[model samples]
Target: MAEAIVDLVAQGLLDEGTRLPTERALAQQIGVSRGTVVAAYADLADRGLVVRRQGSGTSVAAGRRTPVGRHLRNDGFTRQVSGPAVAIDLSLAAPVYDDVVARLQANTADVMAAGAAPHGYTPLGLPALRHAIAGRLSAQGVPTTAAQVLVTPGAQGALQLITAAYLRAGDRVIVDTPTYPGALELFSRAGAQVDGIPRDHAGPRPGHFERALADGEAALAMFVPTCHNPTGTTMSERRRHELLAAIRDHEVLMVEDLTMADLSFSGEAPPHMVALAPDRIIAIGSFSKVLWGGLRVGWIRADPATILRLGRLRTAQDMGSGLLDQAAVLAALPQLDEIIVGRRRLAQEREAVLRAALTEQLPEWEIGRCDGGYGLWIKLPQANAAQVVNAALQHGVAIAGGGVGSLDDQHLDHVRVCFTLAPEILVEAASRLRAAWQQVCADDGTTTILAAV
Candidate 1:
């Protein structure tokens, strides 16, 4: 069996850099003894088919193209797929649709039927949809009409449109450190220098942000005022008002991202900053969470002049958001309260399960007190989060978090474990994780790094 595992890798049949199964999982899959799998790994290491690092466990050599395994197939194609086979996908912050999803599906044809005209290149958006968006924002507090709304494909597109309009190369932008990773990447891609502001449990650190603004480099700031990503911190109204006043004084553009705000995990939704500082805030919202993600729909509520600029940019990017999706989301808006109630109940239940499970299984680690959102940010005791993640992957329990940068001292200690997985898979994944931790912290040197991190 050991010789067979080595022979498969030697033949260039498996793709380079694909994850391999754990000794236990491989043994079960192959109907062989766990000892046989360990011997197979030892044999493979001797031939340099894989490198067995002390802390990192095992991985294929960079040049190795294949491995000897029943799963390996050599039909060369550029079809790259990456996802976890674990029972629960606690990785992505996904919301279940249930009634909302079915209702939208049934009424999708109605929307298409209504907007069944030649919408080839209307720059701003459909008048009815824009009006609906404007109405929604006004209801939320940032009073606006259709003239102030510019519909985009998604929150991402809305971001790009705003960035293109106001940002340029060498421009300085202020962002909260460890905020949405995707938005951070977008800022970098748009050619701007990003300065991170320190944030606490309350909200963005006002002292740090004011200092950044005082530096006179930053002309814009992006913030998540409600249920921030990863941390799940909600910025208090007082804190938001102070920040907005500072932005107003500094003549800075404030971009508000409220994609997850509507989830209302705790029934206390923070006031939208756009309501208080409508003049300086560019508010972006999306239906990806409330509705289905497949619908590429999101909206921006800004000053009419800003909307005009975004309208031209929207024309160049892509005509407008899907008419069908816009209609479906409009229909779901009235049912928004019902959806939030169900989602919050489910999220709370999941959180409770996760908290109890962590207490019973991983007593040493401290779970973040995030009452909202899809996952928990766990602080492990003497464990490398990334090292643990790579190890967990082989054990068939995929997690989220990796190295932030080459120079970053690994953030493996702060991993975000999603509670969205089912109970059985969650238990199995946690148990397998306990097993992986033993291997990761077994050695003195790796254990030391784990301690320091």
Candidate 2:
């Protein structure tokens, strides 16, 4: 038997056009039987990979040949190509990874080693972990029970479960465009129509949501009240009340994702719209940013009946989040305050460096009015963000470019610079960005300016 089979094209180590040696040649060289090589080929065939033809040798599959920097079709829409290898990266919105994550992962493995594979499916989740989560939420005065909390893989999974439980094909789900990119994909996969409302700087545009809901067919609306993504805007308390009243009047179920709330740079959080309207809201919270991305632990706060409905639908997706991820998150919660403090420090320093650089170097650029969140949404004097990003990447810096920042590509001239890099890295990043911006300005002498004055 062969010892192992490797993905031949994994790192371009096996170049796309190159072919592996014949099974007889490989077996003879490695001292393994041809039967083993045959088993390895069978594994490759099972993966929908490789092409085999009668009287012809096998060739590389079509799947692995996707261009290294081509547009990726993720959820539904196709995203533009983002060049890899950069001196600076301001494209990703994720928090920086550090030692705390490693420590938690070490602890997670210890627990799993204790008792990993139990009897048939711990579907609802590990009981001790669920109880810990419930007890934690109750401390927030959100009125949760262990039975009311169903641990999904992430807030993403919880959202899917809720959509699966409530929606049929062709039902309309409301979204604020420039909303969470993943949620847009989730709604698409569920076969639900997304009624995208325009978003203003402070969450959804006033009365825009009202018009979308006017058609009584809208069944659900998802909102990110605290630390809304992309724009770094939060819905005000007054607007929160208005949003609740509007959704209640329309009888629309609200799904609020508070994924980034813990990183609020302002330290001020509005009362969760969910807390204000419990009967109408399904709240999803995550440890992805607060703890670590690999943790992938998130909880859903819903009615007990809603939880039971989710439990039945949960098996269709995953067995539940891994037990050790839950155990690690629970262990990390008491130290959660420490983690948040470290994160706040990192965010504050990075944002300050970015702000200082923008003010001193590129003073003419328009930075949006943001009180909280991890990204800086700024507009160039005349540069097309998409074009600028292309030029900037070639010059050794990569910035996130999209009109998807605001509803309907309204900010097509703008770029979103994520400020979640480590402090030292962020300083060097800003220096490179200053150079990139200069190059972008040089490349755009013919373009007319979009003047705010």
Candidate 3:
């Protein structure tokens, strides 16, 4: 079976690049049909646990890292260096809160004194943390209860739980044309067929969504309506109602991501989709964007039945989220509003600096307007985004190309740059990015030059 091979690879019994036995031979040895073995090998290949070649047989994969590790390493969250000794990482969209560690330390004594679980197994999340999450949602107009909340390591983890519980192999998933890369990867890993809907700055198009759901091909839809990731476009209240009407007629499920909702530059998030249709929407939120990514605290709010089902699925995977993480999130809840205010101000200031720098250095590029969120989605004039990204790395700056967030690779001419750094760094990054852009253009037989910034 696929799981047996996975266990062998995980336990180091089957080394990386080890050649797997031929399907027929293994099938005969194990006394199973050759067809069953073939299916198992196909499943392993799909999960990236094995590699299949044209002439060579299947072999163990080279590296099988966790999703979080892969995300951080491959998605520009971690600054990778090759040519430069120091690289300015503009890939991560997370805000850096300097005092969060101290705040967590200050609350650690109380958390410890109150006594964490002896076995540390709170499957549905710590009671106090659940209540705090529920209260936070209630204040946001969702009217949630602790019984309807389930905690996970982060928004990514919550998505994993939902995918495991609700999505099955071959299920159809509807998403935006260029949505969160992590969500797209997760849904694909669950073997779901992804379909995209076009957008025009008002979030996903409602008619496209309705049509996609009309055929009953899509089992569920994923959306980031407020301060949407990569694009930073918030859906208008009218569009929200339109989508709700579509969902009502189609009776399809929706997964709403509120990860970056609270980071709005206006210091106020829009009304949650779950508020309009709690029974139909499964909402995911995280303290990673608001408090700190290191806290690894996130929650899900849904009907009690869905919550319980997800909780059981989460328990089966890992007993529960870390007790200390839950405690830290609970401690920070009281002052979360003030923290969000500071973050919004910081994002606004940094975005302005980044925009000014990009305008001065890469004047030909089209900079998309962002009302909230941490990054700018930029459209290149004539150069390829992937080439520019590579040249930027050589110039000591790291950024993400639009293909990283695109579902169908249609955004190859664009890039997403985070403005979470200081003003001076933003200015310097723009200078380096300009040089990279020029290099890419020149490589493409275009002679372009720009004055020094």
lDDT of 2 by residue, 224-281 (tens): 8888876777888888888888887788888998877777876668888877887789
| Winner on lDDT (1 vs 3) | 3
Candidate 2 clashes between residue pairs 3 or more apart in a chain or in different chains: none
User: Order the candidates by TM-score, highest first — what do you get?
Assistant: 3, 2, 1
**Candidate 2 weakest lDDT stretch, 10 residues:** 67-76
Q: Over all chains combined, what TM-score does candidate 3 have? A: 0.83
Candidate 1, pairs of clashing residues: 8-67, 8-68, 9-67, 9-68, 14-66, 88-421, 385-412, 386-412
Better of 1 and 2 by TM-score: 2
Model 2 Cα displacement at 146 (Å)?
A: 1.2
Residue pair clashes in candidate 3: none
Q: Please state every model's RMSD to the true fold in angstroms.
A: 12.8, 10.1, 7.9
On a 0 to 1 TM-score scale, where does candidate 1 land against the true structure? 0.74
Clashes of each: 8, 0, 0
Alpha-carbon runs more than 4 Å astray in model 2? 1-85, 106-117, 167-169, 405-408, 447-453
